[model samples]
Target: MKQDTALSERPAVGATPTGPDPERAAPRYTGGQIRNILIGLMLAMLTSMLTNSIVGTALPTIIGELGGQDKLAWVASASLLTMTATTPLWGKLSDIYGRKPLFQVSLVIFIASSVAAGFSTDISWLIGARLLQGVGMGGLVSLPQIILGDVVEPRERGRYSGYLGAVFGVSTVAGPLLGGFLVDSPLGWRWCFFITVPLAVVSFGVIQWLLRMPAHERTANKIDWWGATCIVGSAAAVMLLLSLGGKEFAWNSPVTYLFIVVALVLAVSGVFAERRAEDPIMAPRLFRNPTFVLAGLASLLVGVSMFGVMIYFPQYLQIVKGMSPTASGLMTLPLVVGMLSASISSGMLVSRTGKWKIYPVAGMLLVSAGFGVLSLLQVHSSIALVGTGVGLIGLGLGLSMQILILATQNALDRADMAAGTSAVTFFRNLGGAIGVSAFGAIMTNSFSSGFRSVGAEAIAAGASPDELAVAATGSPAAIHALPDAVRELVLGAFNDAMHHVYVVGAPVALAAFVVVLFLRPTPLRSHT
Candidate 1:
């Protein structure tokens, strides 16, 4: 790997270089110090990402025991809602108070919430704990990246970003497996919450010990309380609308319109509050930066593609292929492997070359192609074909995910680092939230239509209406239990619905590709 001339001349170990702008440049750390700091950050990141997904496989057992079948989805939605709402606030707070203290506070909150979640005697308690956990999770997700930008120069950031990406990929794969294993073992489902406690403690200790950075000297000490309120309220409203809109109430119902109106009002108020605040939660200036805007747009679109497939593919595996939850997770290993490989490799390449546009460009193309391949999947499609489609999607995501952040961080002024990083993250997460809801709505509609058509044919073929209805509304096991002829028709209907999902996703990926095409190719800076 060829090193940039400036990077090659970096200050010797333990020496802080006062670059052209000492105030803006991060404290130069020795390689060992950087490694130690990253270790703590990675552990915290692992805990955060793992918490997001680990509950997935255990939800069934949770509902079975807690008896909140109707409230099952809130187990996931509660966390996501709070996380999204609080992310920008956490970032701004970090910028104001300092990263170390805020980060440790988040860890403390996370640990306490995990313990609370583990002790939950009812679904409501678990949901409340999860919501608190998400508030901490918001910091865990954005702070490490912000801190990384603070510690490493852009030219070398890619190499470390790759490591974070690898951790993300690992956590994504491990969460479901760990959750399933815990549920199956004598330890049971609660341990899923307990298991991360030790990791969070270790991470908290490590960060407190090894991570040290120069304090930021702020121009203003005023907290943007009104801006924060508006931002949080707006985000929470939008998240609630997305999570509960089609399920808890009809899309055209008064409740849906109320949520929409509340979201818009809060959002509009947030923009005005940000513009008028002494220290805005999400700096209004970030919107003026073309790189931030373009990167955020691309990130949002990528989020749609990424989360839509992640949430639905397992269903295709379990519902159509008759795989168990564990088996479905195992089947997605190809996607994780491809993502891990591409993320690490791309990060290394960007570090070496200090060029990143080509990767996301290629990545979006691959993602578009991946969706095309997946759209062709049939009820009897081979495992190899399924692997190929998901693997392609994973590789594309790996190539693009961290690079977008890298690009945004590189373009931002030092003062805007935390707010900018969080904004990009906010967009990606918001996109995921929107995509999941939208795709789910699409799947529901398409499946209902296909199931209705198939039911007519099955009834004509002498299948009972009650049995067909049961299969349509019941679990995968219920669907598979139907007679051979009816089962085939139901599975075909499901397969077609999934096909429609990927087909719709392909254009979204292409839109991301188009958005990235307009991103200005600012060279990665050699100084922090």
Candidate 2:
């Protein structure tokens, strides 16, 4: 029988002589597709994080060699800026253009950029390559959710999302260590970028060979070019202001005010465009759900605290605690372990019980505890204790982050899956940019003040403040070559500077805890 109408909300089917009827479509994901997709996705996620984390350990060397010490944050922030800005656009494009092409395109771009980034002779070139790389990286993170949504029902996704968390945990654990070893063992830092090239090629080949998805029927409609421009402009402008405020200019500077105005105007225009556009870049409707809104806010806070703090931990160990880069990388194992264990365990538990709301409650509490403890860390504190504090933060993060995405997907209609996931990702990235900029600012200011306080004693003893300031960062080879007394003074200044940063970060983390507590309890729906 040929169906004249859609069958049970599925696509229409064939008709027969006896009667015209509709047929229910089989599930989109079958056994082969499921297994292959999982393999491809895991590899993709693993490679992405591994690449990002590996670069963190090598950044100091890369920036120093290129003579753009002031542009260090740009290497990271530029990547993040593009990644955050384009993630939502990728999601929307995936929905319209299909995931396979977009996913493969991202991999190709990332690999190409990785190769180019390695060959760069200066920080500006490196930063530009990194920025280009983010376009690809953004797709890597965004498409997995869309593909999974298309195949798996909401309830089943919790378990699979757990797999992603595990991948993230492992990458976080392994990346810096691997990077540290490579940088220290005569390979130099460029290999950090080169290393991802082969893996990316393999990932792309595997995905092309093994993965297939239903082709999307692209509709004829005007793309929201204006909306996208506004959104991207707004995000970039705001992040730029945040990053440069306390570094390149004073908080009250005219340049800062101009950027602030630009951000506000673009943001306002984006809101207007989204409301009027037939198809929007960032759907405002998602924010209509209070739970989604609250959860998004929470995710933002999590991103801010998590990325801002963890990214600096290696510097702290190398600088204040006087550990080698490799040793500092090793010290992060506890945090990654905690993150992996908690993420995997909590994911399985949520799948089993279909109860997820309470984990965030507990996770946020632990995060607050971790941050509070971390603020107390000094040059004299036990390395093990510092590790324990990071583990606590990881535990909280592992529980709360993925669950929020799961919850948001569950709450939305299946048709809205891409938008919902992108919304969460967007806010989290925004929060991360803000966190890194704000915290980095605090650290810089504190460093200057701390150095001033310690300068007299340091100079009286024969070391200059300039030398001490350079040593406080600890990653530069020049720092390693300094006299022991000068190095000690630098380390002391670094410890004091970090103490100030941590103290401020702790309160922000605590605020996340308070917000999570108020999130309404909701059941984990198996299907949206």
In candidate 1, which residue pairs get closer than 3 Å at backbone N, Cα or C atoms, i.e. clash?
Answer: none
User: By TM-score, who's the top model here?
Assistant: 1
lDDT of 2 at 186: 86
Residue 14 CA error for candidate 1 (Å)?
22
Pick out the ten consecutive residues of candidate 2 with the lowest summed lDDT. Answer: 10-19
Q: Against the true structure, whose lDDT is highest?
A: 1
For model 2, how does the per-residue alpha-carbon lDDT over 245-313 read when each residue is reduced to its tens digit? 777778888999899899999999999999998878777887788778878888898889888777777
Give candidate 1's error at residue 139 in angstroms: 0.6
Per-model lDDT: 0.87, 0.76
Candidate 2 C-alpha RMSD relative to the actual structure: 4.8
Overall local distance difference test of candidate 2: 0.76
